[model samples]
Target: MELLPTTIVAGPSLLTRASALDQVVGKLRAGKVYRREDLAYVSNAVDRHLREMVSGGALKRLAQGLYYAPKKSVYGTLPPDDQELLATFLRDKDFLVFSLSSYNTLGLGTSQLYNKTLVYNHKRHGIFSFGNRQFDCRVKPRFPKTLTPEFLLVDMVNNLDELAEDRNLVLQMVVRKLPGFDQAKLKRAVSNYGSAATRKSFARWQDG
Candidate 1:
């Protein structure tokens, strides 16, 4: 049997790993979602540390390989923030996180606010749960890193059918507001982000 070098598996290296893990754990902001790999660089025994952390109630596993060091309040342990959770799940901060209810604010006659949220990400697609809330994750060809009014206007028209609103009234309002939008940006959104059906519906307005 070959004996490994003493320096290769020294106590100092183990201590350093432990120290790094402890530092990262101590600094983990409450209500922030994290992946196991997010802290793997901190320690070689990261999985062990994570299991222990979960057992000790120091962290909550939100999903497969997803976790958060919770925030306690008078009501209960507060869930991770929506944007923070989405960023961890999608592994990209460049994605857009928005409540579908935001479309209501476009003044397209959508008065009923939706409880749903959506994620426009290049990495993931589907519905995912975080605590009690669910995010409808979608993959898109071209989505702006941030939300824009022009994008919202286009998106509102694009997703018009899916919304729980009066379609005819909303369409009337959309038509009325169409000319007020930033022409260049709206055109790009319709061509890029809008679905085929949406683009077809929007084409009539563009032609007028």
Candidate 2:
């Protein structure tokens, strides 16, 4: 068989690129999410190096400046689910809280494991993917620092069914888990919800 040129034969420096790829993958495997700025801190060569590794199947791009290492499937295809990627991205962005808080606070519903994630943002709904599961962004109009935490707790309760299977279990768990939960605060937060279901849920939490 005819041989290609040495450059084409090597297809770029696999060994050197592999090392760079390993470093990136290591960070991700450690449960760390990275933005472009974070990668820039690692090396000036990150952009080109990352792109090369992505092309070489050493890395999977979640979105711009977000990535994950794919696990091998039975068929040998590397796949990472969307929720995993979004969680990584949210971890990096620092704008997300698990959806369980809502279920717990409102006595709404229950899930064996938490799947849905609530992300706080004012401008746009940030939705993106990593591998299989879908991620959704729900937008809020304004988030004041003082009220934001409470709002997060309240929003989760109001949308409890989005994350759980048994609403009563969720409520019981919240009441059991949260320390020093202010009944006044919970009542005030639920007041923001005019929905009868939310009010009823709040009553259940209070009675619990």
Candidate 3:
């Protein structure tokens, strides 16, 4: 029998690309979502590399500038959480905070998990979604200086039980963080609370 000549195909180039894709996938698997700018910062080839990975099924686009690895079948067809996605989108833009997120952080409100309810300085109109999560972006005119700082403190108080389950400790922490805060704005927020007793209690805390 006559021997046939075998052709050698290039493999190292493919391997190198696969290795880079693996690195990117590893980052995503570790819960790191890269923004386009971050990716650009990491490498000039990041965009092309990311596109290749996306085409090869190694990376899934959660949204523009957001991605994830689909190695585990857990996420189904849905994208990443909207808040997570929005946070990435607004990472460069200041004045974006989850409304309920701040409330949860402040140890003030009830324990209720909400979708991404972000408040930004722009006019309240931009709303979008990513995967199973919804981004309800609200624009606040006038860019009130008290909004972000005050709401963040209130959110800490709202999630006090989750923080330690010791109400006294939580209240103490809240009180401690209150000084140097905008007292008038804080009072207004307390007054806006639905319950008169709750408002009075918070007012006492504010005064104290």
Candidate 4:
């Protein structure tokens, strides 16, 4: 019976891991969203810290590698801020988030509403689910920092057929409404932001 020396490999202690978790959680902005990399500056063991936090009810896992500290309400946990999540996902502050429902504001003979939100950016393109909402990331060559009425109008026309309302009637109404917009700005938007088909469509309306 021989007992060789028992070897214990020393790694970070549970206390150290707990401290890393605390540091990571403490640095997160409540009601805001974060990604694993966003918290990497605080702890290299981010995945473990996040997993423990989620298990402890200190954080909510929104999606793969996405998390929120949550804002409490009598109703339930409020969803993470979409703007911050999208910003983190894209890793750039240069993107536009607009509700597809804004198309209803065009007064194009339909108050039809949609549940999806549009994310305009050059970095990513796809449909993603965030919290309780659906976000459609559209990659564009150029997009304005802030949406303008002229841009909305052009975008509505560009996506007209996809809308639920009477496409022809909405198209006709929008064509008529075009006359009411500032001619210069409308033309510029069509030229810069509008697709080739959109430009052709606008030209047809302008001529007739």
Candidate 5:
């Protein structure tokens, strides 16, 4: 007589899956962002646990493979920190974040208030939104670790077309303001960060 073959089971059983999910959830800290792979070691079924937690509001998916653990305050749940989100998304700490309102500090008479936030990073390019917040990420070949007066001026000209000011008036002000900035540092910033059009324009400003 032929003996019957025993069937083999493939993945974790429901009880084991539940235990793994419990372990994964136990590791969460509020107001922190996580990459999917970050919790993989804690769960045999990380994707399933993530899906279940997302469905149950234990996690908020910020992007593909990205999640946020919301923190509660007296008012309501707080959104993930911008720095933390960018750090997780880019997987790099080399980035510069600033608002368009920073142009006003340049003293070129630009006072427009903008709600937009710009992120200069070497890794990603495009707009990403988290809840009510939006980050406009631009991939730059080179950017300063910190914002500088000279870098801001070059950046302002590079993005002049996008600003809400009169282009000609701003150009005039920029030309006049050139004399006010450190000639050497401003030239270096323009050489390093300026767009072709900005470089040409600054060349004329410097020559004249």
Candidate 6:
């Protein structure tokens, strides 16, 4: 009788997984946000690693499949940066995030402090909550990569109805301030990003 040699096939060891988990955690940076899918290439068992990390407080789940590596400040834990948070959430870098309060900086005679933060993107449309902050996502056909005074002026007029200030008063102020802006840039911004009502209002204002 001939004895057949047996070849042993061993599965991955517990140590191997632990090491991989460590590698996964090591790649995360404080104050950054991530989606589980973003780390899939980092480890074979990313979901399991993420679960364990979340349980161990090494990572915080911001939303479904979203994680944050929180940073600590003198005050307390710092939230993820808005750019990073949105970049991870939408899985796209082409988006604009701004607070309605930013309109006040345009010197348009608007003094209201708006708590709302609006995100304009092509991917997602609707509100989303991440930790304690909420972002209102609006899908727009066109938006600038960076905010500009011209864009803000057009956007404010577009969203005039949603503003808390007296719409008529604000519009009056916008009209009065129109002469101060570069006509070419203002017209281009209005043509590109303004709503139908906004376009008509701006056209009438420019004509006058």
Model 4 alpha-carbon drift over 4 Å, by segment: 1-12, 73-75
Rank all candidate structures by their lDDT, best first, as comma-separated numbers.
Answer: 5, 6, 4, 1, 3, 2
What is the number of backbone collisions in each predicted candidate, taken in the order shown? 0, 13, 20, 0, 0, 0
lDDT of each: 0.81, 0.56, 0.58, 0.83, 0.91, 0.90
Error of 2 at 67 (Å): 1.7
Model 1 regions more than 4 Å off: 1-27, 43-45, 72-76
- Best of the two (1, 5) by TM-score: 5
> Each prediction's TM-score against the native?
0.78, 0.45, 0.47, 0.87, 0.86, 0.87
Cα RMSD for candidates in order: 8.0, 8.4, 9.6, 5.1, 6.9, 6.7
Q: What's the true lDDT of residue 124 in model 2?
A: 41
Residue 175 lDDT, candidate 1, scale 0-100: 86
The better-scoring model by TM-score among 2 and 4 is 4
User: Candidate 3's residue-wise lDDT over 1-208, tens digit each?
Assistant: 9999999876998877767766755555534455666656544379887898789776677676777655344755444543455556666344455555445545443355655565554643576655445566655443344445564554344434544345785566666767767877666555442145556567687566
Better of 4 and 5 by lDDT: 5
Worst 10 residues of 1 by lDDT: 5-14
Tens digit of lDDT per residue, candidate 1, span 1-208?
A: 9998676555887787668667767867788788988778765678888887888788898888999999999999988887788877877787888876887777666778787788888888898886677889888767887888778877887777788777898888888988888888888888878888888878987798
Per-residue lDDT over 1-208 for candidate 5, one digit per residue giving the tens place of the 0 to 100 score: 9999999775667667777778889899998999999978777778888999999898999878999998999999988888898998899999999998898999999999999999999999999887677899999999998889999999999999889999999999998888999999998999999999999999998998
lDDT of 4 by residue, 77-190 (tens): 777776778888888889989876887776666786787789999898999886567789999988788878889888887887778888888888987788888889889899
- C-alpha lDDT (0 to 100) for residue 43 of candidate 3: 49
Clashing pairs in 4: none
With candidate 1 superimposed using the best TM-score fit, by how many Å does residue 22's alpha carbon deviate from the native? 5.8
> lDDT per residue, candidate 2, 23-63, as tens digits?
76556543233466666666548888678757976566667
Among all windows of ten consecutive residues in candidate 3, which has the lowest summed lDDT? 155-164
